[model samples]
Target chain A: MLIKKGAEADIYLEPFRNVLHGAGQGKVMVKQRISKRYRIPEMDRQLRVSRTMLEAKLFSDAKRAGVPTPLVYEVDREDTRIVMEFIRGRQVKLILDSLNPGLRRKLCRLIGRYVARLHRAGIVHGDLTTSNMIFTDEGRIYFVDFGLGGYDSSIEARGVDLHLLRRALQSIHFRITDDAYRAVLSGYRREFGKGAGEVIKRAEEIGRRGRYIQKEARACR
Target chain B: MLCLGIEGTAHTFGIGIADSKGKILANVSRVYVPEQGGIHPREAARFHAVNARRVLDEALNVAGIELEDIDLVAFSQGPGLGPVLRTAATAARALAARLGIPIVGVNHCIAHIEIGRLTGRIHDPVTLYVSGGNTQIIAFDAGRYRIFGETLDIPVGNCLDVFAREAGLSHPGGPNVERLARRGRRYIQLPYAVKGMDMSFSGLMTEAVRRYRDGAHLPDVCFSLQETAFAALVEVTERALAHTEKKEVMLTGGVASNMRLRTMLELMADEHRVKFFVPPSEFCRDCGANIAWTGLLAYLHGVRQRLDDTEVRQRWRTDEVDVPWRGK
Candidate 1:
């Protein structure tokens, strides 16, 4: 069954098979990076292969760093597909408004801690939106779709990652974003320690830079 | 009743006369084309100041109505250059004072969407507003035109214009680039930077220019640039469409004039099974008719700006406005 069709990849729910015994296993998600017709064929192939490999590695790294992520079952670089454990949960974005206030705060703080753990491990979830997160029935938050994820230790990269999440929250959950993001910062500071303050500061600076660029563009116009 | 709208947000200073029924009786614009490079705010403001009288006269003459026939005055109230916005605001203020009519300050970005909705006969659409200064995917949700996605860095049109300037093309590089891209066959690889729903075109522009400087064919470079950038735009618009689930999709702003972009958006709309609408080219570009039409909407909804409250907001956001006209 087709799960979702994104700009870069198409997600499908397929049965996982045991290769050794030719036995049927449970369902798994197959994320295949489709070839873009607009790009040169060779370049498109190269990008798909490299990106598929990179995403699989990043998912494993994130899981090792204490963040909950879908376990990778297999990777087919030739087909630009990654078969992973299918997460049975609702997207956080869809359930945010329905969540109780206390539960929402707790969930946001948990997300912040998970993000801190990833940052400590030098893994950045490049696309950190509520849609990229899932809340399982077990009360655990699982990150999914690491297509834009990367290994980066730079403060700028980490800051940008947080900035992207902040923007996503602001756009998607405008009413609760301010309080939710504050809880996230509190949790991040508690877990990440001294570096957390600096990263937070850098995120603010990055936001200001975006506004400055917009102002400059307007002035030029 | 009639409204006279003054638009001087960017390079164009226009005067449009429209009735309460949304009929544009007259629309005239005088754009400030720089000798070279991008727009200079001061120069553009001066152009508006110099041409304001002539444009107003032309619009009134075309409408065959005297100044007294106008019942209200409107001006683009922001999200634009400070100097340029002030120039238009000043003209609007003076005209309103002389005519003893109410003045309304309208959001320039919202005006674009309102004009599209009015002229194209589309209601409650997910708007892809792409212009020289702004690029945003917006939808009316929760009593406001909420921004679903936007350019994280430079706008799409600015990227195109700057790249064209670097490539030695004429000003307003969108059309010229489109013309050149028609003859190109090769699809050179350029950076496609769409992060979530937001897009970044500055990197793509830089990469395209670098390729052109590295002895690549100009036409090929232009084609790659358009394809990559427009693809990013289309991707974000599609995401917004999926998120909002609006029944209609509308395109507005100057960049909507590009056939390639229009075709891409049309295909996306078709796939989503939603009605697609784009106003005529005259309505697509920055024009005073949009301001006048939107001003009428606000006026009918009891939105009136006092003389003291007519200040221009250079950084006004589309979602900041109450938009009571679009009642819940």
Candidate 2:
């Protein structure tokens, strides 16, 4: 297994071990080893093992919900990472930046519907952003990195996703987002049905309040 | 040869397809019909998803292309609704996968500017994007699009949408009020909130709604409201032109389709001897030709995304892109 390391863990890209060329099945990127700074050796080992299981479960749920997540081929609870399917796509946002509004909204609406499907399936992508998702050459959006994913039907979790998008739009594009953002909302409502409106409203309010609190905290600093 | 694109950033749901050369094949948008009040995000998202499928099919059918012939699938990536984003991403992914072709994710706002670039015929121009979800003046600088002026509070389109709701207009209140304002006898004076390059619309919206509640005709308020807000936008745009010294100004996004705003900016740009470019209405609103163009650019620049990069993020920053921009 070939390994790639990040701040949190070392991902072992299995299925490509000792291979000198590209694997026709695509790459299986596995996040396997995470270092624990706070726990004793035994406790750290157990924590890593459990988190590996948790991440694997999250990936399974994501796949089941048609989220185009990397399929978890295998997992070693002893390690923090699990081997999974490697997708062949670009970040959806990067693609968006290169296109025009018409296409941008179309893709965004599709993304909206996909996420809605996941939400309907009771999966909350705790960290939803343009960078975390991929758009495959096959036109499939495979959502990767389920480290923070969990099962939640709470409006707050969903709202937080929306809030993150709003902030992302404000911070990322900061241009030509008006109709584009609303289009995303329209897609959301279509997928979630009537309950989405109130939820979105409440989410917006919560987002506003959250920003206000953050601003105050920053001022205090 | 052609690709269908959809946009749902704010209240307006736009559908458009473009050819390989950045030509709009077909474009359509259904503005949100605001209820008793302003737009409800979730309601708007629902409307988009329902209308988007229909629009997508319409565009594909109109262009006489099957799912398989869609050489590449393109969709907006983010800076919008999570649910809505998911909807678009899912549709594109499914379509691409089903067709066994490539899928390209395009940024909603950048597409607007790219379309403007193609239509306006400017080498490098200053952009004033005013819509429901965003309000900013942008200029290309340091291999990235830099913001020169923006709304510190709510977006311009959101402000307009809210005010339009007060005026009994639909979700995308800009056009509704624009139509009604034509017949209104008087133009009331509203606050023009512009500070340096930064602007404010929340206070203006609150006041406009209040005046409407205080017995002002919705039409007059609408006309005056648009004029006030647009005037502020124009001032900042001119300032950007002055600061950047760019001779060409390109107007994109749904708001760019507004004739009054376009005319005002044109005249302002004219005063500075700067040419102003507003794309044809087809390019103004959300559409996919921009995506095709963007995809082409990314592919050309060797910025293809790896398969292991699969992660749906609610936040993606544009400056983070490592690709170097060499303007034409």
Candidate 3:
């Protein structure tokens, strides 16, 4: 079944079976990068193939770092598709208002910890947003969609990653942003230890740089 | 009420007269086009200072109204070059003080959207504002215009212009590049940089220049550059539209005059099944009318700035200003 048609990719739900082993079977999500008609066909295919392969690698890297993510089952570079374990849950963005205050805080804290772990493993979720998170019935939060993610250990990259999340919170969950983000930072510090402080500091610096650019741009105008 | 608006934010100095009933009586503008390079701040300000009176007089003549008949004065207060903004603000203050009319300072970026909304008759749209110095995807959320995405480095227009100049094309490379791109049949590979909702164009610009220097066909290089940059823009815009679930998409800013960019945005809007709007080419570029129209809204909503507060802000963010005219 067709799930969602995003700007860069189209997602579908399908049942997958291990034909070689004839043993394991489950539902999977097939995320196919859609070819943009405006792009050259060869260049488009190259981008799709590389991005698909990178996403599959990042998923495993993030999972190994203690972040809950959908398991990658197969990567088809030729078709620019990834068949991954289908996550069954509600998007956190849709359920944030419905969740109890304590649960919401706990979920955000866990998300912070997960993000911290990913960063510690040199994985940056480039498109970090509440919409990219899923809350399963089992009370676990799963980070999904690593299409824009990559392995980057630079402090700047990590800061930008967190900055993206902060902006997302400000935009999507403005009501509980302060409390939720505070919990997130605390949880990140607890999980990542001393390194968390540096990343948090860097994130603030990045934010200041953005403000500075705004000011400079205005001044130069 | 008759409101006179002054706009001298960048390369243009304009004066517009509008009434409370949404009638634009006159809109006159004089642009300072640099002979060989990008705008120089002091030069632009000098141009504004020299032409401000002439433009204002032309607007008054076109409107057939005396200065004493104006009920209010509005001017673009920020997000521009310091000298240029100061000149316009000084002009606005002098006019208001002389006439003893209420004066308001408006955000130039928000004014662009408000005028587009006013003229296009669009309500609550995800706005893609692309210009030489600014590129942002904005939508009214919560209480203000929230920026969804923006250029991380150089703006789309600047990217095109810089590349065009490096390739020996004239200033304002957007039109010339577009003209050349029409004849290009192939798309050379160019960097496509989109991080989340934000995009980066400096890399694309650099790569385009490198390819041009390496003997790649000029038309093909231009084609690819535009394709890559515009795709990143469309991707971010499309994401914002989905995330906000807005019912309409509006394209405004100087770059909105580009036919290819408009076509790309329109296609995305059609796919999302939302109304698409772009003001006429004249309004798409900077002008006094937008500032005037937006200022009228602000004044009607009881927004007024003290003379002391009339000092221009070099970096006025669109979200920093409150939109009392837009009710939550």
Candidate 4:
């Protein structure tokens, strides 16, 4: 049964068995990239296939880089689909505001640390929003949704990735943005080490370029 | 009550008269065309200053109202070239001072949205405002209009304009590019960048230009550019629409005049079973009518702008201001 009709993919939850790693019965989430009738058929197919492969690669790359991500059990290249381990945990987006200040800070800090790990390995979680995260009952954060992500080690890509996260915090969790962002920065600085400052500075610069920071105003000229 | 609005944000100097009932009495604009290159802010401001009296008088004459009969004055107060914004602001202040009426400064971005809503009679909409310098998807929530998504780097319209210039097209090249795109059959592959709801057009622009220089057909490159950029925009707008669940969608700003964009958005809106609105192209572009209407909305809501507080904010953002006129 179709569970969620996302723009890029439709998600389905079904029972599965991990035959490769011993008999383990569990639920797996199958995400299929739905084709759009609006896009030209040729380009649409090309994008779907390439993006599906890209996302699967991102999952493995991120996992190997020390980030906790859902394991990709199977990939259907032609259908542009993936069957991955289903995360049975509360999404960070829904529970963020309900958490105590201390817990919130710790959770946000963990999120920052995971992002640092991804950047350190030259990967950007492109859609780095709270909704794209799952806070396991085990007190760990698992990143999801590599749909928009790309494999790039450039500082601009890394910085833009963080900036996108900051924007998410401001828009969705406005109340705790100040503390949440600061804690995230602290954790990032701690984990990222020598290269953290440059990425952080670039992130700030990227933020300024958006409509929000508009310092030098000139247009249509 | 009647309010006269002045718009000189970039290259156009316009004057429009509107009543409190959201009726536009008269809207006249004089666009300053640069001689050789891009618009020079100082020259544009001088154009606005020189044409201010005639434009204001003509607007009043067209509105069938005397200067003394005006109840308020409004002007575009920002996110634009410094000299241009100041020129419009000075004209508005002088008009209000001479007429002994209150004055309000309108945010250029919000003005575009308001004009669409007011004219289209749309209650609330996911607005895809695309212009040469700005591309923002906005929706009203809580007590203010918030940006759902926007361009991360250069806006979509700018991408087309720059590519047009490189293709040896004249200034204001969007239309010329669109015309050429219609005749092209091939779709040269171009970069399509959409990160969540936000889009990045610089890469697409760079690749399209590089393809043109690499011996690809000009029309093919133009077609590919439009296809890629417009698709990215439509995709982002669809995301915003899905997220907000707004029943209506609006397309406005300078780029709204493109028929292909309108068709693409219309199709997307149809697929989602949502209403699609595009105010007449005249009111879609940067105009005095939008400023006048937005100012009237703010003024009627009891928002005041003291003379000391009427300074133009070159960095004004759409989400930064409170929309007292709109309710949840």
**Model 1 ranges off by over 4 Å:** A5-8, A17-24, A34-50, A209-213, A217-221
Global lDDT for candidate 4? 0.86
Residue B278 lDDT (model 4): 97
Q: How well does chain B match by TM-score in each candidate?
A: 0.99, 0.86, 0.99, 0.98
Q: Which prediction has more favorable DockQ, 1 or 2? A: 1
The iRMS of the candidates, in order, is 3.1, 22.4, 2.7, 2.6
Name model 4 segments beyond 4 Å from true: A17-24, A211-221
lDDT of 3 at A47: 77
Question: Which CAPRI level is candidate 4?
Answer: acceptable
Tens digit of per-residue lDDT, candidate 3, span B1-328: 9888899888889998889888889999999998877778888899999998899889999999888899999999988878899999999999888988889999998988988887887889999999886898999998899989987677788899889999999867899999999888887878888887778888899999999999999999988888889988888998998888889999988889888898888877877789999988777788888888889999999897889889898778887899999987
Summarize candidate 1's per-residue lDDT along B1-328 as a digit string, tens digits. 8999888888899988899888999999999998887889899999999999999999999999999999999999987888999999999999999988999999999999998888876889999999888898999987889887788788899889989999999867988999999888888988888775678888999999999999999999998898888877877787788777788999888999999899888877877788999988888888899899989899999997899999998878888898998996
Give fnat for candidates 1, 2 and onward, in order: 0.24, 0.00, 0.28, 0.29
DockQ for each model: 0.39, 0.01, 0.43, 0.44
TM-score of each: 0.94, 0.56, 0.94, 0.95
Q: Model 2 residue B78 lDDT? A: 55
Q: What is the descending lDDT order? A: 1, 3, 4, 2
- Give candidate 3's chain B TM-score: 0.99
* lDDT (tens digit, per residue) of candidate 4 on B54-147: 8888888899988888898999998787889999999888887877789999998999999888888788999999987689999887787888
